[model samples]
Target: MTNTRSRGAASRGGWIRQYHHPRGDAPTLVCFPHAGGSASAYFALSAALSEGAEALIVQYPGRQDRLDEPALKDLGELADGVVAALAPWTGRPLTLFGHSMGSVVAYEVARRLERGPGPGPAGLVVSGNMAPSVQRDQGVHLMNDEELMTWMSDLAGTPPAVLADKELLATIAPALRADFTALETYRHPEGSSVECPISGYVGDHDPHVPHDGFLRWAEHTKAEFTVQVFEGGHFYIEDQVQDVARSILRDLSAFVSRRLARHPLA
Candidate 1:
């Protein structure tokens, strides 16, 4: 699609970073990054699934190439913006994978996309987040800089080097705070559900969301639902990228095949 003079390529370039685009007929996997995470985090997963799928990773504002732009402070605004940007890419089947804060963002995006006349996602994969119905009043976003760092230190996935470096921490602090505020302030609308199948990936040792919270994901999707428990903490997928990518590709390929079988012309 890049070699041709098409507006789709230009439109997609705004919020998406295409790390690997293979030459073949395959579905696209639109990946959402975690809080304080960038699109580059999925580079390895994109490379691993290069043959099976095209990975378009999201690059939110105030990070990496778009550091000058202000970060999005509202979950609904972020979802709406992403869904609008994705209008050009819904011509083919698409799947979504979101981790941590990305999970909620992905779900919101899916909800918005399904409401429109455009093509809905084939499936949704949510990781490291409890169901939307599970409410908590953790105001980590309102914490002072030192308090926020202390909380981050307690989390299993943060790198010690990044936490220890005052310069780097200052650079990323704004975006991080914005993301936390978004999540902290979010309240899921009652009676909301999506038509696409939903899958949950949970870390066995994650204290944020327990098994019951993960299982509650089944309540939000009318279609099929499944869950996988991996060994580790919040960022467990980082330790099992190959396995996670393989599983996602398998499920998405099966979904595409089913869709084709249902409507031979699709």
Candidate 2:
């Protein structure tokens, strides 16, 4: 993929950084990051799995290597673009892993790919987000700027360095606001579900989504379903990512094993 991308002379060089062994008979596991995050955050996760798998995390624009580009709003615009970028690769069995705002992005990506002309995902790994149909009850757009800032402060998952740095904040705030605006406007209808295997995980003390909301994710898929609750707060998976990675590998093993039994490749 690098040579193909390089030959085309992409402006960002290798926009898709290879974080894991790119070669193997194993499956491909792609990760999407939370809002205001990038691929670098999961650079170490592939090692934590140690599974026979090749993993790559998508680098959203307006951050890190692609910082010069305009940022994606919420999951919809992001997924619309991602599905096109993924057209070349979705021929193989696919698995999506996403955290927090990333979960919504991953879900919508899967949804977009499933609709038009792409292969189905082997499975989906969603963490730290509420159910698909659940939107933020407290509207940040309705709130004043100060109230919104307070909400951001309470989340505390966004890095303090970015929040405090006026220079960087000037660049990041517009993207952040766009992300929230998209999320605030997002709404999944009742019984609207995905067609792939799905797993949902969250922390015990997460304030964003309740346990029942996580459980309802089971209704989204016809394939195997798993819901796990770890011990911590909303951002618990940040430090406990190894545990999340292990959980991903476990389900991915099953998905890949079944695929190999059928296709015997990819």
Candidate 3:
């Protein structure tokens, strides 16, 4: 799959990938991929929102084209790198979306942006993960290769072909472990919350996220909070891309309306 780089996108040190370009005035939607996932995972989503928004998918280190780069084992460091890479794309209203480990990273990035000089995210959408405040000690990152593969298989997030291919699994294992280590070791400060609204999404049968887990995201936002449960497992978006895209567009529209009400002249 060939990807087109928007002007200056290549200057971000390969941290961002743009699959489709939207109108210049359109809102920006920055997507963070799940653990062991690459920016290509969002190609379909970016295509879906091509007309309504500019979608920028993050490309984390140590995966895909960035295989040579070492993956960061700390979530804070990962967030820091993302925040820095996003500095060039903050001119317009932006919304953030992330799944699984990416959800936590997006939250951290939103927090940092809120604390910085520029405007923070117009809103945030967190999917397939629990709230940052809720911490569990399931150390899958420390598991042996076989055990880790078993857990991944149970989650059904990985493709069967990739799982069956030992060489492919071995190639991605280090980056997968690094992502899991960052996710598992992350610790959110009590009472830390973003000022923007938050929308949570979860699959009804996702084992990693409890049935009511998405609701916890409300605690991390100071503004309006909402959640929608979809059918399927952790990778529900794969089957419900249109629905997910609609939900995102709906939330983004609402966020824009709210912002307009607050600052009519801007």
Candidate 4:
């Protein structure tokens, strides 16, 4: 496996980012970042799993290299863009992992893929988000700049340095607002569920979603469902990257095993 990070023009796709090269035979783990986060957010996890899985992080518009592009304000549109952009990499087994708002996006993408002719993701790992069915209308998108920054501070998702720097906060506010809008306004239709196994993770002390809320994800998956509780808050993965990577790899391995059992000749 080749380990390298590329952010040059050649690496700039509207959606996917492959920071490291893994074995062709390795399963692909497609990661969706939390709201206001860029693909670079998953760089460490990508590096950690470089040998076991090909990690492809989604880069939504209005951030990083795609800064010039308009940010999507609807979850459906975001999921559509991701599903289409994933065309070339669907040949191998795929496991979708998403955090915060990205969890719903990953669920939607998995639903779309299963509805299509191709096979759906082998499994889904949702972190720091409640099941889509549990709707909460948080008006974070409607907050003014000051309020928005304050909210981000309370959640501890944004760094103190970034929160304190007005100039930097202003730069990312648009994308952040757009993401909030998409998340707040989105609703998952009743009975909408995925065929893939779903694994949920959440920090024990997360302010946004409680442990029970995380377990509600079981309702959205027809297959096996499991949950892992970690220490800290919503951004727990920030401190537990290695443990998270190990859990993800274990899920990916199980997915592969299940896939092989279904089609042993493959």
Where does model 3 exceed 4 Å of error?
Answer: 1-6, 10-13, 264-266
* Model 3: pairs clashing at backbone N, Cα or C within 3 Å: none
Candidate 4 lDDT over residue span 5-38, tens digit each: 3223216577888888676557778999999999
Clashing pairs in 2: none
Q: Candidate 1's residue-wise lDDT over 26-95, tens digit each? A: 6878899988888888888889888888777888888887789999899898898888777667766578
| Ranking 2 against 3 by TM-score, winner | 3
Judge candidate 1 against the unseen true structure and give its global Cα lDDT, from 0 to 1: 0.82
Query: What RMSD, rounded to one decimal, does every model reach?
Result: 2.1, 3.2, 3.0, 2.9
Model 3, C-alpha of 214: deviation from truth (Å): 2.6
For model 3, how does the per-residue alpha-carbon lDDT over 28-145 read when each residue is reduced to its tens digit? 7889999888999998988988778778899999998999999889999988888888877665456999999899999999998888766677889999999998885598899888
Residue by residue across 107-197, what tens digits does model 2's lDDT show? 8888776776555677789988877786664666566545655676787676777667777766656556666766777787567778777
List where candidate 2 sits over 4 angstroms from the true fold: 1-15, 141-149, 260-266
- Lowest lDDT sum, 10 consecutive residues, model 1, at 1-10
lDDT of 3 at 233: 95
Best by lDDT: 4
